[model samples]
Target: MQASQASSRLGQSRTSIGTPAAPRAERFRLTGPSVRLDPRIYAVRKDIADIALADRVFAPHYAEAEQARVAVPSVALREGPSDDARAVSQLLFGEGFAVIDSEGGWAWGYGLHDHYVGYLPAAVLGDMGAEPDHVVRAASALVFADADIKSPVVATLPMGSRFAATAEGAFLRAENGFIHSRHAGAIAAAEQDVVAVAERLLGQPYRWGGRGGDGVDCSGLVQTAFALCGLAVPRDTDQQAEAIGEEIADGAALRRGDLIFFPGHVGLMADGETLVHANAHWMAVVREPLADVIARLQPEHEKPVLSRRRVLP
Candidate 1:
């Protein structure tokens, strides 16, 4: 909707599959003001935009987003349409992509799961299939050509990736390959502990904008952890800092699963005094004393803690 027209629909809200209700007008207000629309989450370019935003923004053309799904195990969503461009995020197997446009072998769209907008190679997207029925529960699950353990591996699906499958003895028969039933679980199943899921990625390489088990960043780690627990959250640190659970007093004591934000960064509280994160300092996912993290980051950012939030009851 147009920026000026969105105010009237402020009370209207819609929920995505398996996610909480979010007011559409509220999102427009957050990213709709002609000058305020964030390209990172809104598919608006100088020439064209997603038809959904036609009311709020001006463009020579507004196109309907064609539905597509990630066909590869994982594909980088880059800042630009080239492989050399900085990767802004990743689209994992079976995750939906709303293709607003495609050109020069790249598809420009937003990930339906996170609303992260970027350019993914057109080859990585394919027809949207049946809704995913299973999710990889392990750090990474190998997809084999056949149900046999010795079968040739066809793909390596990251944790949190979803797919449709049918039980076949000890395996789940997917369209492309067979996955060990033990490595996957019903998509609707949710782990009770988000921190536990984060801990599983311990020692994983730290990569900016990477969210898979192979590599991940601070906010990516947080988002992945929450996602495995069946919770939906914004993809970036600043957004998480603002939209996540209620904030605590500056010096309030923290507990497990609490989110501690630092300027341009965030980490999960492993305990009252410990923090777990995919950090650049270590170049890997690691856990350390909260005091130590504060000491190391203080000189650079000044503020030791930006905000502390508790997400779990």
Candidate 2:
């Protein structure tokens, strides 16, 4: 949609995320004066019904002027084809993301984390990459705009370089003998059609409420991952478990993307056999055999097993 047209729609429309619902067809008219988003400049999953649901769907500038950094050494990656919301960019750090874009259930934002600067699904952000300075582990890889891992020559990534963030696909789902864990902090990559994205972040840093490339949490990790894959995830473990539509019996045929929860914490499994997440004990992201981790965490609660809901894209 043209900016002028979008503005006109914003002026005429009244909407919100938590408002009462209308028939989905009455939402927006792309052919009308209502501002439709630019497919080239920004895009959400086509399955999304409306763009007017957001206050601001896309913009050339950051909605608010702010400087933020990745607080954690590693955070969730989102799903975006553009530089704005591609896997992991540094732009989300303390950047003021506008609610201009939409992808069905998700919204988009812009930030310094994404040097390319554009709209992305809003759901990928962990509290909008809220930050100051980001945390970086000793051996960290900071991906920049002009990055080329396939290239033979590239500058060495310094330990502390701020890049832009694009999107967070899905929560990391982990498994143990009969338990599931989704370590959002352990996620490394997204947008790839993998069975388990959480296992990819095995050995990432551990940061609390830290959703940057620096550090992240169990819930943050899960929410971040699903955002990239165009999945909407909640920020807390309990809330996340409820989003799973499919539930596996304790010992059912275990697979990837299954969530594992503990009494006070949660994590994700990369595969039926291995789990991934950051830990205060491990001090970083790691993958443990599902059966072993379950045995360790199971003894804590009378039945520490809370609820397992399957939330996948």
Candidate 3:
């Protein structure tokens, strides 16, 4: 009749089960030989049944943050809206939870918590604490793997810069290994996520080493924030440009979040014709007319206009 009643009835006539008691035991643990229950109380009763069988149940007031310390390891963190971004990152998948689960291509998670629910793959979760709402300054390279603070070119981070998440092998053991890194982290990222997440930081700030929303740079701005949100965009605009979608030669057809790029620089297309970026040349993060930004920085024919990223499900 009702959902609970149906469950109770189904639990009783589990002919497929090896024993009559097995169905009840599988669904719940509260009811005993002498007990029967109203259908409305089936779920509550079942919970008690499971607990009675277990060695222990959770403390009534256990903190979510504490509980999160042991949540099902984050098996995946992919890009796109909460619908179709199911593609997985091979290296970083199944790494374990770093911080809270926020939003995804298909679903949104708690600020920094996970449940017993199995929703997506291992690519969705970033390394522990790699993605934090609040940020701290980087004294050294924040070395994660084989790296030291002396080589800023390797990690590409300046001293006293703030960052979001650091992986163990991604940033330190760089494939190119030419871009000298002062800090070495094992942050294994998808490389394409930097541009995707960095687009969110447009109009923020162009701090030399600042990575959070407070301030960011051409490369640091893109690389760090994406890691915080469980995406991994590249460190530079050129390499990142390749990762995004086709070129938007004209700003008229550009979408809201489309990214615009210039020689050695990048910005985002905001509203009708606004470009958002932390302009080092201008010394502040602000919005400009799309036409003007393109005319000033980009070439007439090859003006890097639209670099759309498909990050939603």
Candidate 4:
């Protein structure tokens, strides 16, 4: 009999092989802020698996993972483990990440502050140390090897970078070097007027993935301002719209510190009637009457305001 005919006959006889063939392998979906995977029942990538049992691999839960601190001035979090990969976000100095796994010269992990996951160059990370006592508040601040401002600059810290410090007469001593005290603020301190932080970046050119003083995006402005105030927020508009704070039911209720979200943009409420944002429209950070912004963008976006989230309250 042909193989197909023989299989048909075997199917008719219920009882058969030494043991019933095992059920088809099952796959479970695993997701995080920056990755998604369908891991099979018996096999899981080391980067996504938490532990390996005798016959199966377990997904990473991040419950007791090791932590590392970003030691460089800034590092790019890329989508893949390569230098040419697209950068999804940037980590300022002193930001922390939960080390999930390491491969080649990259570390796959999640940001401790925003829970953003991606790969960071391994050389930029360091063992966790004392918590930061002060944060660099200037758009960019220069660190000197000595307290003297004339000394050769050591490192240029981006706004929102934090470090352990002790105040000298006019400078703050950090592990790397001495930074002018005026450029630093107590870590526990928060800017009550978040809008004021946004105002300082008035002419900064807009960049799609920028998060520093020289250039920034809409969500970057909001994120950097909040960071100066010791509040942790995510990097993108969608995440910010959903996760930052409570929603305001009325548009008139919007106030300073309230984050206004549009289709794919975000801005901070400067006052009862003003909105401030790093906009590509203006190609720079600008403040405008809330009503004007609403009227102009509403027609284009099909709606003026998507939602208003009160991040402070």
Candidate 5:
């Protein structure tokens, strides 16, 4: 089945951003020419002989041989090599991956961004090349085939998509199209106001495994916001809770850019009293009083806050 058709069949419903889907072990087993290996661990085809095994993630069954770049605006990273599998995450345009194995039109590999392992349509990948020079900062930006604004839009790049570019009059000459200079910034640009970046996604609907303006989950919201500022964070809540910035001993001390964690959710501190998140409760990105959110969740979660970390500090 095609990736798009499979995604439609699985249904893109709102899901808890805090919880990842069931372990790959419980999903499906690899068979035939593909050796059964832990889905979390990277693996390649069983017959390939010219394999590089320097990386710990590469073994007899797993080898690092093929590399590819994302060729679409966004592609699903699924639990299995089939389109019917649950989407665990998404690969934005221009993202790179190491192809460890293949099954027909599906490629199982590890995402270079967060080192996430999953399956994406082999058709959406291309040969890797030079690293991107700029990242799309807008929620979504139109890419024109020419520098003229009147020109037809060739593609729409979601926030966080990277591409090589050079100044061309009032636009930047990108690999696929011309982008307005105002919509993109240097990949190494200094971190800016994360709150402001998140506010742009205020009305975007919440989606499971979504990280762009189309839809976004709590951690995806936080991750996307910070990523625009050139900061990197884990993709899931539990890992984020353990790996991100310094922990604040007191919730009262929380300030802007601080991350607040709940039992299975997360939100960014807009200020001392305001919280911004892509919450299922709202079915969209919304800002609410921190106290009200804590009070509402306390009954069901049994705890108001799990941990507070200052990502900016």
Candidate 6:
């Protein structure tokens, strides 16, 4: 399902940002017109192909993915390699990207964190330097030219941004600038509650495909919350509902951390009766009674709660 219309909950949050691994394409090749692939996550075009899919797909050229990191605070991965193209998702600072091809100032590849494939401006990426040792845990963090807060703000990063840094007195020295140590947490530092991460992002503007503090959508909000805790989740709602957590049998009682699904939509349960979600209807992240959301959504859209999946013990 399209992320713009669907709802999904966050994934499990772990303490450490794990290593960025390349996507392992299937070993067997499928020959013929019936070979089906999801274009959203597979970097295959009529002329170019991700090396991982070389054996499974036909292309005149196949290239191995080069490791790259986002140098800018955030950049949009678009439908095409142009400013006018639709942004499928936003890549946060320090997120890993596997570049399978590049031309005319655009890089074609997929995100290492979620494997979403798209075109991004080539200028926003840099050589992957040191492995990330920390993640931005605050809703947003400012990068200062100097250790002091009064220094010029060079950049701003959304939550879930990762980086490698050294402690410089009371501040952390990142490649871009110094950030207050309090704004970041060690990659291994796990937040115990997933709901707390979602609550921290309340009031963010709802943007389609936005996954961080600058802007966020339904699934983006959930994905960002989990990423901060060091977990990678699919970028869209249908994928999230199909892959994340176990299905709760029908008529089962609801609990915190349950993924509440509607027609092309998903939300996280704050409690049995409360839900937190980023919705276009409200134009922002909102927390309210589950009953109120259901009442409003059902009449307006003719969609009811479809399923509830439990993601926490």
By lDDT, who's the top model here?
A: 1
RMSD of 3: 16.4
CA lDDT for candidate 4: 0.73
Clashing pairs in 4: none
Scored against the true structure, residue 35 in model 4 reaches a CA lDDT of 33
> What overall lDDT goes with each candidate model?
0.84, 0.43, 0.38, 0.73, 0.75, 0.81
lDDT head-to-head 2 vs 4, winner: 4
lDDT of 4 by residue, 16-52 (tens): 2333422432223322333333321111244243222
Which 10 consecutive residues of model 2 have the lowest summed lDDT? 172-181
Off by over 4 Å in 1: 1-35
Q: Lowest-lDDT window of 10 residues in candidate 5?
A: 1-10
Report the number of the highest-TM-score candidate.
1
Compute the lDDT of residue 125 as modeled in candidate 3.
36
**Clashes in model 5: which pairs?**
44-100
Task: Residues 15-42, candidate 1: write the lDDT tens digits.
Answer: 2222332454323322344545889899
The clash count for each model shown is: 5, 80, 53, 0, 1, 5
By TM-score, rank the candidates, best first.
1, 6, 5, 4, 2, 3
TM-score of model number 2: 0.44
Q: Give the range where candidate 4 is weakest over 10 consecutive residues by summed lDDT.
A: 1-10
TM-score comparison, 1 vs 2, better candidate: 1
Model 1 alpha-carbon miss at residue 244, Å: 0.8
Better of 1 and 4 by TM-score: 1
- lDDT value for model 5: 0.75
After superposition on all C-alphas, the RMSD of every candidate to the true structure, in Å, is 7.8, 14.9, 16.4, 11.3, 11.1, 9.9
